[model samples]
Target: MTFNFLSPVSDEVLAHNELLTPQALGKKLKIHSKAHGLPDLDNVKIAIIGVLENRNDINYMGSEVELDSIRKVFYNLFPGNWYTNVADLGDILKGDAVGDTYFALRTTITILLEKKIIPVILGGSQDLTYPNYRAYDSICPMVNVVSVDSNFDLGDSTLPIKNNSYLGKIILEQPYNLFNYSTIGYQTYFNSQEEIDLMEKLYFEAYRLGEVSKSISLVEPVMRDAHIVSVDLKAIKASEVSKEQKYSPNGLDGKEICAIARYAGISNKVSSFGVYEYQHSKDDHITAMLVAQIIWYFIEGVNCRVSENVLSDSVNYQKYNVLIDDDELIFYKSKKTGRWWIEIPFLPDVNNKLKKHTLLPCMHEDYLEATQGKIPERWYKAYKKNSF
Candidate 1:
C-alpha cells in the first residue's frame, strides 16, 4: 500500500546500462522498471529511494535533482562479495508542497521499516532527515542519529527549516523519540560557538574533522549506537568529488567518508540511512561515482557485520573495572568480536531511570585510558548525562 507513494524509475535511466559492462551493477541489482515491478520485499535488506524536493533547501533556485545522475554511476559499480537482498524502489516524486513530500517520505520509510528494510535515501536536501527520524517513532521506542558532516545543521527552529538547519526541527519536534544524536567530522569553522555549546548542553557528541581523519576507528562506537545515519556529501574534500559537492576546501577525504559509511552499515542498530546535498551539474560523474562507492562500502560492511557479541550473556564477555578518583568504571570486552563497552552506572533517586549498569559502546583505547587512572571521555560524558 505504501508503494503507492513511489513512482517507478525512468525508462531512460534503466536503458543507460545497455553499454554491456558484464560486471556493472545494472546487471546485478533488482531494479524497478517498466517491465519488472518493485522487487519482492520479503528478504530485501536494502531499498534505494530517490527524492526531488528542494524547496526547503535554502539554496534551492529551480535547480534540477541529481538522483538520476547518482543512479547512472551506482548502476555501473560491480557488486561485491555480499549476501543481502537489495531493491531499487524508484523515486518519490516531489509533492506540490514540501510538507507533502515530507509526509510521503515519512509514510514510505515507516512502511519499509515495518518490513525490516533499510531505506537508503538519495535526497534533494539534508532536511529530509527529519522525516527519516520521524519514521522510527512507531517502529522503535527510541532512536540514535549519527550525522557525518562538516556543519552541525542545527539552525534556529524559529526560522523555517532548511537543509542547513533541519537538526533543529528533529530535536524540537513532538513525540521526542530521539535517544541520542552524534555528529562526526564536524569542522569548527563551519559551526558557531553557540551550537557547540548546544551540543555540550544536550550531551550530544561531535567529533572534529581533523581528529577523525587522524583516527577513523573512533566513529565505530557512535555508529554501533546509531539508528539513523545521515551523510551530507559536502563533508567530503573538494579534490575528491565534483565541484558541485565542494562545500569546503578542507573536509574529509573520499576514503574517510566512505569508511564512515561502512561503519554505519556495520551497525546492528542502524535501520535507515541517507546521503544528501548532491547537486545536478556538469562533471557529476566524479561526485556520483564517489557516492556510489560509499554505498558499496556500506553494503560491504553490512555483509561483514559480526555477531555472537551479545553483552547480556556474561559467558560471551570478559569484564574489567578501573577506578578513576572515587568512581569505578566497568568495561566489557566481547570474546567473539573483541568490541568493548563501558557501563554507565544508574543514578540514585532519579525519575525515568535507566536500568542499572547500562552498557555504552567504547573502544579498547578507552579501557587503556581508564587503566591509566583517567576516565574515558565517553564514560565521563555518559556518567554526567546519567547524573542529570
Candidate 2:
C-alpha cells in the first residue's frame, strides 16, 4: 500500500530494452508495470526510483527525467554475482509544487526503509537529498550522511530551500537527528571560507577533491560510518557528463566516482543511496551508461558486502588499547575484513547518540596516528561531538 503513490515505469521507455540480450539486466530483474502491478516485494532487496522534481535547484531548473535513459544502459549491463532482487519502481512524477515532490519522496522512501528495502534513487536535482535525509527520521534516532560532491551545498537555511543549499535545511531544521555529516571531494574554490570553517566548527568532515583522488580508499572508512550517502553527479568530470551543472575540466574522473560509489554500497551502515543533479539530453547515452556503470559498481559493492551482514563476533577481532595525552583510546581490528574501529567511552555526564556504536569504524592509519601520540582528527571530532 505504501507504493500506491508510485507509478510504474512507462512501457514506451521499457520497449527500448528489446535490443537487450538475454543475459542483460533487463531480462534478470523484476520491474513494476501497468500489467503486473508492483514487483514481488516479499523477496525484494533494493528498490530503484526516479524523482521528477527540480524546481528548487538554483543551479538547474525544470523537471527533466533521465532515469529511463539511464535505465536503457543500466538494464543492458550484465549484473555481477548480485543475488539481491532489485526492482525498478518507476518514477515519482513531479508534483504541482517542489514541496509536494519532496513530500512524496520523503513518504515513499520512509516506507521503503521501514520495509528493509534500500532505495536507489535517480534524482531530478540534488535537493532531493533533503527528502532522502528526511525519510530516515522515523527509522533512525540518529543518522549520518556522507555526500560526494564538489561543493558543500550548505546554502542559507533561513532563505527558501534550493538545491544549492538544502543541506542547511537538514542541519537547521527541527528533530535534529543528524549525528555526523561528511563531504567527500569538496573543491576549495567551490566552497566559501565560512562554509569550510563551519564544517570544522560543527565537527563535520569535508575532504578536498585532490585528497580523495590521491587515495580513493580514504572514503571506505567514511562510508562505513554513514547511514545515507548522497552523490552529486557534477562531482564527476565534464568529459563523463556533458550536461553536468558547473561542469569542470577537473573533477573526480569516471573511475574515481565509480570507486566512491562502490565504497558507499559496501558500507555496513549505509542503507539508502542517491545520485542527483541529472538532466535529460539529446545524446546522453554515454552519460547514461556512465551513470549506469556507477550504479553497477554500487550494486557490485553491495554484493561484496561483508562483515556487516554477519554479527560481529568478538573472537574474530583483535583489540588494542593505546594512551594518547592521558585519554586512553581503544581500537579493534576485524580479522575477517582487516577493517579498524576506535571506541568512544561513554561519559554519562555527556548526552551521546552513539549508543549503538561506541566503536565507530576507522582506518588502520588512524590507529597508527594514535600510536604516534597524536590523536587522529576523526577520533578527535567524534570525541568532541560525543562529549557534547
Candidate 3:
C-alpha cells in the first residue's frame, strides 16, 4: 500500500557516474532565456505522475523503468537552478486490487488538479488514460482530449475495461463532447470498420499516418484546442522504437513524436498530459533514449510556455464547453460581442451547420446549469462561443 517516489537507483551508483539527482532534474531543464516568446513559470505549476503498473496486455506493462530513464535524462539535460515546482507524485502502489490501483491513480490526479497544477503522467498502460480523464473531471467537467495512437482503442462489444479500450469506457461514461476528440496516427490494420464507424458517429476527428505526415499543419490546431493529451508509445513505428502493442510498420519518426510533444507542452489549455504503453522489457537502448528524448522535448516545451505567459491570456476567461448528446457533442465558438456560435457540430452529416446564436446575458443559474456548476456562465458562454 506504500507508494515509492524515487526509482531503485542508488545515490552511490549515481554519484559514481556523476548522474544528476532527481532534485536537480527540473533545474537542469530550465529556460533562463525566453525563446519562442513562451510563458514563464512564475505563476505556473507542473507535476509529474509516474505509474509502474503494467497489466492487461503484455505490451502495456513495465513503463516505470522508462520513466526512470526519463528522470535521469532530465537530470542530465537541465543542470541549473530553474523550474517553479516540480516533484514526482510517485508510483501507484502495485499488488493492490485492480479497483484499488484505479482509485489510487484517480486520487493522485485529483490532488494535482485541485491545486491547479499541470500533470505529466508517465503511464504503465493506456488504461491510465481513463483514470487521468476521470481525475480531470473533478476539476473541469468538459475536457477536449487529443489522443495520439495507432488504434481506435474502441474494442469490440466485449467492453475492454482493461488497459486497451478504457478510453471507450471514458467516452461512454463521461459527458464528453466527441467533437473535441481527435485520434491521430491510427493504423488501419489495428482498427476495425465498426470502430471507425463509431468514431464517425461520435464525431471524433481521426487522421491516418499517411494523412498526418502529409498534413502536419492539422496537428497544431488540435493541440491548441485540447485540454488534455494522451500519447501512446505505439503510435511510433516499430522500425523507430519497438515496445508497445499495435506497433505499426509505418508510423511517425522520433522527430515527429518530439514535435507532437512540443506542441502539447505549449498548449496553455492542456492541464494534463500522459505518455503510455512503453514496455522496457522489449525496448532497446536506442528506444529508451528516444523515450527520454521525447520527455526532454516535453519539458523544454513546458518550460518555454510557462516562461512566456501563455496561459495568462486565458486565465481571466473561461474555456469553452462541449454539449454532450447520445450520438454527438457540439463545439461552439463565442464572439467577442457575446454570442453563442456553433463552430463545429457533432454530426458530420449536417451541412454548413455553423451558425451563431445570441447568448443571454450571464446569469449564475444558467452558468451553473450549462457547466453543471463546474464552470462560470460567462466563461461557459464565451467557451461555447469559441472565445477562449
- Which candidate number maximizes lDDT? 1
In model 1, pairs of residues that clash are none
Clashes of 3: 18
Clashing pairs in 2: none
lDDT of 3 by residue, 1-388 (tens): 2222223333332443355455455342322111212223344477666677666554543344445555555555543233555544434545455566677777777776776778788867787787777776657755678889988777642555776677677777746533357788888888888888887665567888887888675576567667778998888987887444336678888888888888787666677888887666544556666776776676666665632221233333344554444312222332322222222322233432224332222322333355553433233333443422
Q: Superposing all C-alpha atoms, what RMSD in Å does each candidate have to the true structure?
A: 1.5, 1.7, 10.8
Residue 271, candidate 2: alpha-carbon lDDT: 92
State the C-alpha lDDT per candidate: 0.86, 0.85, 0.60
Query: Can you write out model 2's per-residue Cα lDDT over 306-362, one digit (the tens) per residue?
Result: 854223678888889998777999899888889888887777776776554477788
lDDT for each residue of candidate 1 in 311-337, tens digit (9 for 90 to 100): 558998999988888888888999888
Error of 3 at 329 (Å): 19
TM-score of 3: 0.69
Ranking by lDDT: 1, 2, 3
Better of 1 and 2 by lDDT: 1
